[model samples]
Target: MLTILDKYILKRYLATFVTMLAMFVPIGIIVDVSEKINFMIENKVPFLKIAVYYYHFTIYFANNLFPIFLFLSIIWFTSKLANNTEIIAILSSGISFTRFLRPYIIGATLVSIFVLIMGFFVVPVSSEGFNNFRYTYLRTNGQQAMRGDNTDVYRQINDTDFLYVNSYNASSKTAFNFSLEKFDKDKMVSKITASRIQWNPADSTYTMYDYKKRTVGALGDVIVREPEKKTKFGFELEDLTPVIYIAETLTLDKLTAFIDKERARGSSNINIYMVVLYKKFSVPISAFILTIIAVSVSAMKRRGGMGMNLTIGIAIAFGFVFFDKVFGVIAEKTTFSPFIAVWFPNFIFGILAIFLLRNAKR
Candidate 1:
């Protein structure tokens, strides 16, 4: 039971969304190329690799900015409809505002599903490539970037085991000043120290250099020393080296498991990871929220017409981005809950959408 009006509005909504994405993605590419062309030329990166990198970059950019584009497009098209008296005409034809919103809701639902898929699967793969290329070619130094807060790694391997490393090189799979401590209940059982540790991929073991171990017992303590020792620990090499974008490269299920693993390890930056996890769902849900807000704000005929609606839409979109960033930083820097930080803007804007929709209906 589809009406002509429903199909018309739905088609326009989706068409405008795609058109906006098409327009903005090229601009993004041009600006990014202008900024990175020198780096590509200096690095002597092949044209094919550069093209592939930008392809990943396009997916990353579009996925990240979809909500902003969605909001703006809805405002643009709905405002035009208002200016042309189409909204009034439809209302006079006995179509209620609530009925008019059906197509928009359907469109938002479709976009939300797409966003969800992108967040859970597509974006992660693209983000991995995007970050890999940026680090490999765009960064000035050959040094691979580490997480800002993860320098000098330390973590609990399990209930009875703890680990520490003074410095680590991800590319080399090596660490310096490695220490592992084991405890039995409240008593210290043993401690191992090594001058350096390197992963032996062939054996799936770590080779510890200048290895020393001390075991404590009721009667006495025993000490052992070795020049080098190959041993398997409870943790893997990937556990020792964590990158800033590690969370961005995991799917929803993997990210959930990762957060749990990091929590068990007593990681200090768990909040940052939690933010990424929550944002995957929040960003897509924001599409529905923003669609409502956009339609509410722009579905009224006004003196300034489409220009005024677009201006308001842009301002609101920027404000949403600002709130999201500020609160996310607060969660990262302070003790604020990541769940609240990730969803606070949506909560605030959802209320705005409700208020605006009511006013528009009146």
Candidate 2:
């Protein structure tokens, strides 16, 4: 079922893509180390931890540039084939352009599958390590970075209870001006307020200062106060203070569950999380479109040769990245649809690929 030509092109396709990743990933690591070496040293980070961090960084870096590298590799090798007139000779043997594209399609399918696995499962673990290392060692406002929007925090715990905090400090595991209100139907049942609350991780309990509880009854209201009180709450610290990068650290199923939980809590960052989830699927899908465009752009022997083709290819690749980032930010910040933001780049470039394919066939 396999021909020599299919095997040859597929070999070149996969081999070149691997080589590109090998080359660029190391360079990216070096640049990152150069920038962060002083920070690592200042924090007295151990060498082994640094090594592990870069291991995770390698996956994160490669995943981010996967589509770009795949596009460039395809362009580079296919341009070489064109320059050698190998494509012309192959076409003269009566193979249709669509048929000639079969191996490339197969190669794209393979790469897309790998991308899907990496995006949905592997990259999340790497992202957690990469971001945790930065927040723990390199960032100045590490607590603020780890705990998103520590001020004016609010959460709907369940159908009957709601919570509010004026401010939280992740470093100290403390919250100020905390309140929990429980409702029975449309009426308030009881409300608890604390001037300060601190988690005692040693005993898995919370110590509150100036704590007060007010209960509403049919006859009247009853109130109890204490200067210092220790008790357990229904929620954990994470429920009160979720990290900004929590979405990036969760795998497909966990991410989906987290989104559902956040939705129930009426979180304002739903759009941002939606963008991340959509991109996990969209990034892999772009591999197919990028491969098609790369082949169409580089399959013809142009007057400007491989360099010209590469220039064009790189421009298109960056333009794709630019669109992706812009739309993603718009979705995250404004009310734009995350689905459109994630997939619009592929849709636009898909049209470009079609036009270029027609010209290449001519």
Candidate 3:
């Protein structure tokens, strides 16, 4: 079932992909370092931390653009094969074009599995580290970036309980103009108001300033007030308002669970989180799709040779990235379906690949 040609192509497939990653990731790191070196120095970031950040950056960078790298590598090597007449000779020996695609499919399957694993497990960890380091060290207002939004926060704690805060301070870990309301079957049962609320981790309680509670009863309404009060609540402040990038920092299981929790809380950013979740699977599928497109485009020898193939490959790759980003932004900002937004690029390119493959076959 094995052949020398299949082995040769598969080897080149893997080697070229790795070579592209190796070549570009360092250049990415260099560019990033040049941009952030002043920030790192200003913040007095430790060298060890810097090294670790770049390590995570390498994984994050490579994983993000892996499909492009893969597409270019295939085009690079296959165009060489075509230009050298190796493919012409092989085709002359009676191997059909479809048969020539077998090794490519095998390579795509292998890379897809690898990409899936990295997206699900490895990339999440590195994304956390990469983002954390950037926010903590490189950003001028790192605390604000790392913390959730500060103004007009609202959350549904559960079916009957809801909360509102006028503003929150990440540095102080305080919420101003905090209000909590409880309802039983659309009738307000109790309301709690505090001018300022602060979490006391030492006692695992909330310290409320100018606190007031109002209870509604059949008999009448009763009100209680205190200048300062300390009590425990069912939720934590951080849980109510997580950082925007929190989804990217979680592994597959944790991300799923977090999304479910956020859905229950009626989060406004659910689309953003769903986009992130869908992309993990979509990126792997893209490996197969881009591989087919790359092979189809480069399999035929042209007058302009590898350079022409590369130019076309780059244009196609940029188009794919452009579609992905535009749809992703639309999904995050509007009511667009995240699933469609994530997969639409692949669908468009998959059709292009089919047309190109048919032409190549002809």
lDDT of each: 0.87, 0.87, 0.87
Q: Model 2, range 41-92, lDDT digits (tens) per residue? A: 7778888889989999999999999989999999999999999999999999
Worst 10 residues of 3 by lDDT: 141-150
lDDT of 3 by residue, 1-362 (tens): 75999999999999999999999999999999998887888779999999999999999999988988999999999999999999999899999999999999999999999988988899989987887676567645444333343456777787888888876654356878999999998999999999999988788899999999999999999999999999999876655343456677778998899889879888778898999999989998998889889989999899998999999999999999999999999999999999999999999999999999999988
Question: How many residue pairs collide in each prediction?
Answer: 0, 0, 0
Alpha carbon deviation, residue 263, candidate 2 (Å): 1.7
Model 1, residue 113: distance off in Å is 0.9
Best by TM-score: 1
Clashing pairs in 1: none
Stretches off by above 4 angstroms in model 1 are 141-154, 159-203, 206-231
